[model samples]
Target: MTGKNMKNDIVNKKDLKQLVIRFYGKLREDKILGHFFNHVTPVNWNEHIKMMYGFWENVLFFTGDYSGDPMRKHVAIHKKHPFSLSDFTHWNKLFIETVDEMYKGENAEIIKQRAQSISTIMQIKLFK
Candidate 1:
């Protein structure tokens, strides 16, 4: 469906969950990024998905629903298998595409911007 046909901003937790699930679905299937989640670190998807829902919810709405040091987790993963710039770039690309495909308006735009900013920060921290 086109953006015109699907005109709904990510307004609440339900929307956030849908976006997270869909975005991670793509991430799991992604060639470059998938290995990190599926092999490198081997995420427990059930818990991870719930964590991400809270993460994005807090990110967009400041709901204080999530609490975890994402950087620390990534740092540990980096020690196990170093992440390159392309990993972050592809992550941002997939995130933006997923958001664009599923949402629009203020929240959608903010989430994309935040995802990009977060990706950039992660690259700097991990690659530095």
Candidate 2:
């Protein structure tokens, strides 16, 4: 099925991989947030995508295949460029939109909720 049609179709490793890759594709092009990935460090797309796959898999499925200090990384990035509340809002919007467009189910809801929670914590930590 087409990627959009895949929404709510199924949740699994392969589908989660697609969701992450597709989401990042849109995220990297976003006007408000694009610079972070595109200009901040000149992202290694393959590596980033791989790491994201592991992250989402672990988050959604408890795969235990991902490990990293996301908060510390964001803190460093915030020190460098400073993400604002608006940036986090835009990120949440994109994250929800991406997840809703690609999947809809328990795991899909969990992803969106987790994104919201992550954004909330990041905002508090970065701006507090």
| TM-score of every candidate | 0.93, 0.90
Q: What is each predicted model's overall lDDT from 0 to 1?
A: 0.88, 0.84
lDDT of 1 by residue, 1-128 (tens): 77579679988888888999998888888888889999999999888898888898888999846889999999999999998887787788888888888888999999999888888888888888
Model 2 TM-score relative to the real fold: 0.90
Least well predicted 10-residue stretch by lDDT in candidate 2: 2-11
Error of 1 at 50 (Å): 0.4
Q: Relative to the unseen true structure, what is the C-alpha lDDT of residue 83 in candidate 1, on a scale of 0 to 100?
A: 87
Candidates in order: C-alpha RMSD to true structure: 2.0, 2.5
Itemize residue pairs with steric clashes in candidate 2. Answer: 8-104
